[model samples]
Target: MSKAHELLKKYWGYDSFRYPQEEIIASVLDGKDTLALLPTGGGKSLCFQIPALVNEGICLVISPLVALMKDQVDNLMKRDIKAIALTGGIHADEVITLLDNCVYGNYKFLYVSPERLQQDWVLEKIKNLPLNLIAIDEAHCISQWGHDFRPSYTKINLLKPLFPNVPMIALTASATLDVKKDIIKQLEMQQPKLFQISFARENIGYFVYETEDKGYKIEQILKKNPEPSIIYVRNRKMCHDLSFQLSQLGFQTTFYHGGLPKREKEKNMHLWMSEKAQVIVATNAFGMGIDKPNVRTVIHVQLPENLENYYQESGRAGRNGEKSFAVLLHHPSDTVSAQSQFIHSLPDKEFLKTVYNKLCNYFQIAYGEGIDEQFSFNLNHFCSQYQFPVIKTYNSLTFLDRQGIITFSQEYSEKIVLQFLLESKEVIRYISLNPQDEEVILAVLRNYSGIYDMPTAINLSLISRKSNQPEAVIEATLLRLKEKGIIEYTAKNNDSSITFNEVREDERTINRVSKYLEAQNELKQNKLQAVLDYVTDKAHCKNSLILNYFGERGTADCGNCSYCISKKVTKSNSEKDSNVLLKLIKEKPLSSRELQQITKISEEQLIFALQELLDNDFIKVLPNNKYTIN
Candidate 1:
């Protein structure tokens, strides 16, 4: 066997690679820069990973999501591979140690976010590492035309000069032709080999239902399927409300969102992964690197802002190559709501400037100051204080971040720190007095060290496992301990945060990218229109429409999609209508309006049958626009 296959078997335990994965790996092993466009759940990671393992030095993976990085690192570590992810929540000393490990300790993979590439210290450190290859995940983010564009990703080109000899591989799950070209040009790949696996997932049946009572439809769908499923909504509140509704209908359901605490999110995710929950209601934030293969259905209760989001989210189903369903439940009002909330609600340039200025003032940063300064942002408080609309303000901040003026992150894992106020002897006395909380207290002390000297991160789950108690019990004990002045426990806070990348400037600075922002807004409107077209157009094949949107042409109709199935039913019913019309005409001559009242078919179907009869001389129309038997 080849080295790639051997390592793949040894590490990933796979006998062979998926289609185009082996080819991509071969190109990478041959030291060629490659661009891979694989659909979601298509094993894009293995293409770069197997090659990195076959090669000599460490692989530097520049990714956009911290959750994805952590997930991959965890998975690699589980297979006895050395992998580390350097994200925002780590301390500087720990980062130094991790970098040292990557350079000298023979770590195989070092995953960092795109924003970290702009840090001079990080760049200097990376120049010293024995990097064999650079892999960019979510590579489409480098393109402004892509759905999820990040300005920080544009700085990835800086690494090209530093690692001129090393080959680079850029991978994304979804990208159009324009986005693909932009990625190559932005990364400056040298004679890159392109590998695009077809985006068609044959095992998935796409269905769009126009429903007035979505809850009843959802319940009915789940009742019929009754398998592991994911229901995606638009907001956090809807996640909880829908999950609760499902629970009331006797479904083992849970919900997840980005705003939840770390432990709670982990618990809910664990429940769903372990099959303890049959359905998980979540927002778009829930499923980045989720590897559950048995997810039988993914239902969208609300329309996504674009086809890209819908395609990627729906692609999460049928990972095991088994039959599954991606159903979208939408009403007319949903289209209006999505367009208004996503497109029209985007703040104008003046509003964005106002938000930026207010943000600076909120942080008390004067002009020419606050470069690299980080602050915890409370969206509710900020909005209330400034009397600005919450959604608009949030979108403005996001756009500002995308313009590279600031760095905004809302989805980092929260860390809980605990420091004991009492001395060791006093703590022991307190624990002895409160023996009910002894298990949790001792578990915390045993699992995490230096909590008494300084505030250190405490793992509630680990404590729960060690104590053989529920997480709730452990938390209650910690709260009791904190109340008695034995320890100072700080709970995890998962709020949004912002960092100024440059000193505060005038409104002109914010308007520097105004044209670009306008272009993005226009692109968004177009995407929204495409989504509306997909949901509303019933004559075309759903699969073909999606494929065409991504620039894939000449796709045949998927025989199992809702449109194809409905067309088959219509054809059968039309033949029956023609026969019924003939029988009715044989009884006696009838006018068109009289035939319509007698026939049990729709007007369109009746007209179609009448035209067929006329062409065949089976029926004739009189001068009064009446139909009669011939």
Candidate 2:
């Protein structure tokens, strides 16, 4: 067997690669730049991972989300693979050490954010590493037309010049034709090969329902389906509110959003994954690295701003190819609300300038000062002090960051560090004195090394699990140990960070990207219009509409979609009842009840046929609640 196949079997226990995976891997192994457009749950990671194992040097993976990086790294470690992720909020010394490990320690994979590439030290260190391949996950972000555009992704071209001979692979689950072309152009790939698996997911049944009472409708759907489900909402508050409502409706449910602490988020996610919770109410932040295969339904309470976002989120269902549902509940006011909230509320150039000036002032950086300085930012406090809307303020900050004025990273989790202060004999003596703290302390010591010399990052949850103790007890014991001066413990903090990229600039300099920003705004508006069009359209097949929007054409109508099924039922009823109505009307004008009695049709069916016939001018309704031929 080939080395790639052997590694796949030994590590992932897979006997064969999925469709297009082996081909993409072969292309990369031949030292060719490649782009793989796999759908969600199509096993995109294995394409890069298997090749990295087969090759001799380390593979550099550029990812966008810190959570996704951490998840992949953890999974790789569990499989006994040496992988490290350099995410935001890590200490600079740790980063240097990680880079050194990649160069000398024979690490197989190094995952870093695109923003990290902007650092001179990082670039210099990467240039020295024995790099074999450069893999870009979520590659669509490199393009301005993508739903999640990050300006930092454009800086990735710098790596091409640094490692000219190394092959590169870019992967994304969702991208339009325009975004696909732009990704290749921006990355400057050398005659890259393109591999795309069809975006159509045949197993998922698409559905849309127009209703006023969403809560009741949701309950009805859940009761009828009664399977593991995801309910996606727009905001954090709605996550909690909908979760509470579901629980009240007799559902074992949990909620997740980006604002929650890392530990809480993990706990809720574990509950859902383990099937302890029947439903999860979440925002878009919930499902990046989640690999649950039996997700029976995905319900969208509000319309997403674009089809890419919608497709990616809804695609989470039916990974096992079992029958599943991707349902959208649309209220009459949903479109207007979505447009006002997502488009009109975007930060204008003047507003962005005001935010930039305020941020500089808040950080106490004089104009033309404070370049490359990092600070722990409290966005809530800043917004409260300045009386700025939190969402709009966040959008403005993101704009400034994308314009290359600053680097704003909101998703950062604090790292916990622990150091043993007591000598070995002294530690034994203290442990004897405090028997209650013995289990956790011993677990920490057994799991981690070099704690006597310097603080090491510790996973308290892991310690709790191994020690067979509750997390709260383990935390209290650590605090007691700290009080006794036996060890030093630093609890994790979840906060955001900001780094000034360029020296403080005036309004004119801040507005440099105004034209580009306007273009982005227009794109967002157009995308929003597309979403509205999908929800309001009732004539076409839902699957066909979605496929066409993604640049696929001539897709057959999915016979099982809500629209198709409704059309079939309507046609059946009209054909059966219209014949009777036409025959009765031809004999004589008659009352509705008389026609129903003569045709032996139910009242509802008779009325429906009469309406259909009247619509076609084959019959007409008279003044006294009677029917006649037109």
Candidate 3:
């Protein structure tokens, strides 16, 4: 028994390893970059978590879900292990402190969001740490062909050189052949060995139903199988609406979406875990980081934009090796709505540029002005700033953020602000060369709390009003201090999460660069659709279709899907028996006409055919001496 197996037994309470677990750990222990593509519910966390404990240094796990981070960390802590998750919810000072602790605190696992990887502090800290391994959960996000593609994920390769000697592991439950290659390329995996398990959920009963009244249909499903369920809708409002409906029907239901405040989101998630709300009615955004094993059913009241999403959301059910239902309640209009969303969301090149320009101009930003600055951005303020419609412009800005041109994290944009890192006496010496900072230094010190050690929360408007200085002068003074290495400032604005350097480039060059970015997005979306084609396909066996998509051969249809089950039904029925059953039923009033058909054939043969039809329930015999098709 190795150290990993020992921890698995002692902490996780598992006496033995699952299939391929020990092998995957051994490969990592040997210091190899490994990609583990296991099916959902295959215990992927154990493969990475156990190795991190047995290894020499800390394991850095990159994931997008805050709920998932908290859950995993909490579970680990319960077992007397040290784990922590760093997300955007905490203050910058808190984050720095957490990272510092990870460095010197002897923690085994440190979970971080992808967004954190973009920050200078995060990147700088990782460089100095003796990292044991890097684990990228949902590695498919790095692939353009995946359902969830994050542009920041493309920059993941930047971490490679920082930890050249450290081995990395990329784990995802779902990925097509194209996605696998993309993940490797995006991460620049070192010719790594890939362990891809077949994407098959034999215990999940797959059912796709088309209905006219979605709410009523959902009510019907809940009435019968009222176990722990997830009701998926397309938007935030719909999640609330259906959750209310289900609650009215006496089911404990709660909803989740991005629009909710982070606190409320976590609260609702807590309610879900405690079974206070037995069902979670939410949008596709709900379950990415969720790992509830006993989800008895997943009902999609509305259809997802593509099959990749549907497959992932459905796979969340029956994680405990128990039977579960994945039901899709789709209508003709749903298909139309999904298609329309895909088409409408395909922003054009000109639109992206115009929106990008409007956003930059609204912030009064020039070609390259904001570098390493964080700001509070309100989307509505920008639209009001330029008289542009908020919705479309907001969408465009997100696309730009997705394209890595900007970062728009705030719901509202506040003015630029900062404070002195040094006191007035200390500031005097610093400003001796310029002799122009005395007034501004006093103004910043008189206001803005806690500026000496940690960066104070700054709203530029307050500083300007108190200092009686123009906004430009205040902005300029802060920039000078930042340049002089005296203090740092973050500009909070609404729109793209982009940080532009003060380096000015010709306007034409910027436009040309924007065009290339748009071109990349267009190509990426097409590749994503190619993966969707594999998801909704009804012609082939699920296993064989997935295998073939990934360029695998010697694959056959697994007798486990809806199609395979239907085929088994057809095969069990003889063609001649099907014909005889149909003819006998139409002839009517044939009392046990079993022998009559028998007289037409040999008695033994006729009896056998009738029994086959009866066994499959293709025909029904009435008490009134009449046989009919069932």
Q: Against the hidden reference, what TM-scores do the models get?
A: 0.80, 0.81, 0.67
lDDT of each: 0.83, 0.84, 0.68
Per-residue error (Å), model 2, residue 303: 1.0
How well is each residue in 242-319 modelled by candidate 2, as lDDT tens digits?
Answer: 999989989999999877876688799999999999899999888877879999999999999898889989999999
- Using TM-score, give the best candidate's number: 2
lDDT of 1 by residue, 294-368 (tens): 999999999898999999999989899899999998866788799778987888888988999999999999998
Off by over 4 Å in 2: 89-97, 368-376, 401-407, 412-495, 499-503, 506-509, 571-630
Question: In lDDT terms, which candidate is top?
Answer: 2
> What's the CA RMSD of model 3 in angstroms?
13.1
For model 1, the stretches where C-alpha displacement exceeds 4 angstroms are: 89-101, 412-415, 420-488, 506-509, 571-630
- Model 3 scores what on Cα lDDT? 0.68
